[model samples]
Target: MSSKFAQNRSFKKNCTAFAAFFIMSVSYCQTSTYGQFWNEVQFNRTINAKWSTELNLGSSYSSTETSSNIFENNIQKSFRGWGHYYLSPRWKISSFVAYYDNKDVPEIGQFKSPEWRFALQAIYYFHKTGYTLSTRMRMELRHMRNGDDDYENVLRYRQQFKYLQPINSKILRKGVVYGIASDELYFKSGTKVTGLSFFDRNRLVVGAGYLFTDDIQLEFAYANEYLPRDNENQIVNAASLTLTFNNLLPNLNKKLLHKNEANTNED
Candidate 1:
């Protein structure tokens, strides 16, 4: 038991050191910087006993420095939605589709058709610190407007960790404030891609959230993304505001019903 515990400690120490290095490099060691502000609204809700769904809407404003003009302006508009089906106690499957409209991007050009992606993912859930930690593995296929005659092919692998720590102990109450942190590292492989490093980018975000009952949530966060290029590494700084509403129509119906009941009582 002593030997096992020692090994676990060593492993955790190494992992923590690596994560710190990655985050520091991204936030401080990049060039040709940009600023991005984003807004997102998302929902995740359970359906029946074995299914769930997610809906997301988001947009962004970005500006980068270039010699041709003082600073190039860009905006991104997007939507993402997915559905989940539980297959067992610890495993599930998800299908997701997303759309993006980005301006002044090198990959998609200044003005062109929007980009689209479809993905299928498998998720495994585990318990840690009395909370759930999810490991999601996904594969995506993409379609975009490009000069190439064939579609772009890329494979990505990402690992994300999320945790919510409650500030209130009352189970019957309708509100709770929690802190959350998530980190994701990305890699890509494809036919038309060329890069010196197989590991491309890293993203880290930390923030607090407020949950009002089971219907709504609000979160604000700061995010940093590292992009590797041939000449230099680039860093994009972002601030985000997110609002999530679960079962929108159902929640509205419940409010209306309560209002009608109050009127009947008065009569």
Candidate 2:
């Protein structure tokens, strides 16, 4: 009886999240800045408890302002890869690079330079609710060209606060369902000396996650973004999907835990 009740509750929560996302998408789609739609998938694998890596593949399209039609733009392909390391239980760091190749759409015209970026990041963990809470900080160097001109160099900082809350504790023995949300702010690293403005971009995301096991999880969400190049009044909405796999090194986590326990015992 209790198990069935919990399942019912989980279903309600999932439906609520989806409904809210749908409403937000519809409400925002009416504006000129809102026609950009995106779908993406990501994979993450752990080399061990201490090291992990990621790959993300995605595509995006935007409607022409004049036509205001749905899904009218050509697809933009993206590739991203990163590696993360656990320094300790509470701290970790990552470095990543990404590339984007956007095809010519009548509305946006051709962009000469494919955009690419390299960044280093650090995350601090403070809480665990089955779904964890953490903050991430990153510094990025972006390389891009709009035309025949030289590549513009921009240094950016991004800070994000994230929450992951589990829905069904009983079911967590085999799998778990959770809610996740995060907000990120971007800032230019320098202003007077670098001649770059302080503000750059911002992003907000909300979604739910399901963990099939400690080894695998998937997340689906909606993202709203404010880009510096786009009109200030416009907000771009994107759909996001991510998958995570852990323990690629098999017994490495167990070995590490055992080793740590042994060290503590000796002390």
Candidate 3:
């Protein structure tokens, strides 16, 4: 009983510290704020015991002060492909290539060209009794055209800490609901970056996810992004929704076969 009490106390203390950090990071910048809505769909496949892949398609819409609807204006569309190799159950390394098609927004004008980005990342997971904690580090190389129509090469690094807790069960599984919280910081340096501060942005996300089946999961999250520019800092409040399908091709084939069998029996 005493050991259990000590463990509970430690958990509470950690939670309190995390809350304080998240609040401070979000409040660090008070500037022009806008609203956005983001939607994403991901398809995941596992090839072998140690290898997996993912493809993602996403889009975002922005809202201005004068806009009647939050998702009134389309701002960006993106596609990404990722390959992952698991070193162990608790560690994974991944690389991805992404393309972004950005449109002109009232707050930030159109870019001279769209962006192509490549990133390498590693994630380490710590399994606890009823929850999991993860840390991810990513390095990104971005290629884009600057405002002056000059090609720019940017290097950026990101660090993220994420926590996951199951709400009604000890482990996350089919029909399970889980809560997630993550904080990420970005730092950048590039030829086009003339800002004195290398600190690019911070993103804080809090959300919940539901696993409908072994192959499908859906998540909804609220993200707070703080970006500091040379002149004016900006904050974005975004509502994000993501849907993931695992083992997409195999699952689709199985469903199709099942349907056909049912139709034949009916006939």
Candidate 4:
């Protein structure tokens, strides 16, 4: 009952945040300044020593105005499930199925985009020292529907490279930092579209994370983005706090109690 209540509260909180985001976005539609906020709730489990499954729920809201009279706002909500399989100790393959919706206008708002994404990744690890080189190739199946218009399906691809380095190891041990660079390419292949052209989007991401224990972790990340559709570059700031459980959730203070008992036995 307590767990159910807690989940209900969290759902309500997320809804409230989404509502606030919409309000703020609409209100700032006529200004040059823009703001966006996003949140993600993720869960993952190891399917085997080399395979894993991950689930993610994410929401975002953003607003911008090209001029005093022209305003644009965006709201997105997505849920994704993915499977990751390691080909080698430092190389992996990933496939994902996702359902996403974008809200563009207030009157007849909502565009559905269900996509399937696949990726291959390579990671190079340094001996003893905490560092890694990461590279990836990504492809996606994009289904887009706008208002009453017929849906269109398309294919998109991206290539990315990143460097991961350890930052701090005390208190929050396993602290690491990353520098990422990515380029996105789109392929227009469908029955409903005319001219086919490639659009490129670039991003830079930097972040740090810590492993509190084997079962718990926290991370914060920030990104800068450039999209071909928008004339002005955008900046994104993000933060996350995650809790990972191996089998089931454990009581946080159980280790302290066990340590006390062991000391008593020793005395």
RMSD of each: 12.9, 17.7, 14.1, 19.1
Shift in Å, residue 81, candidate 3: 0.5
- Writing each residue's lDDT as its tens digit, candidate 3 over 136-204 gives 999999886666766678888999999999998998779999999999999988355334468988999
Q: Rank by TM-score, highest first.
A: 3, 1, 2, 4
Candidate 3's TM-score reads: 0.83
Task: Name the better of 1 and 3 by TM-score.
Answer: 3
For lDDT, the strongest prediction is: 3
Q: What lDDT tens digits, residue by residue, belong to model 4 across residues 1-267?
A: 999999999999999999999997666543233345556767777777898888877776554444222223446777888788887776678888887766652212334433334333343433245555566677777666644566666676666666655555312243333332333333434333212335534656666555655555555556555433222223333232334343222343676778999999999
Clashing pairs in 3: none
Tell me, by TM-score, which candidate is best: 3
Instruction: Report the CA-based lDDT of candidate 1 relative to the real structure.
Output: 0.72
Model 1 regions lying over 4 Å from their true place: 1-30, 66-74, 88-92, 106-113, 129-132, 147-151, 170-173, 191-197
* Model 1 agreement with the true structure over 89-193: per-residue lDDT tens digits: 788899999997766653233454466878888878775553456676777765654444345655666666665555664321258776667777777664343
Better candidate number, 2 or 3, judged by lDDT: 3
> Deviation in angstroms for 104 in model 1?
1.8
In order of appearance, the predictions have TM-scores of 0.74, 0.68, 0.83, 0.61
| lDDT tens digits, residue span 18-82, model 2 | 99999977665543355556666666776777998888788777666565553776557889999
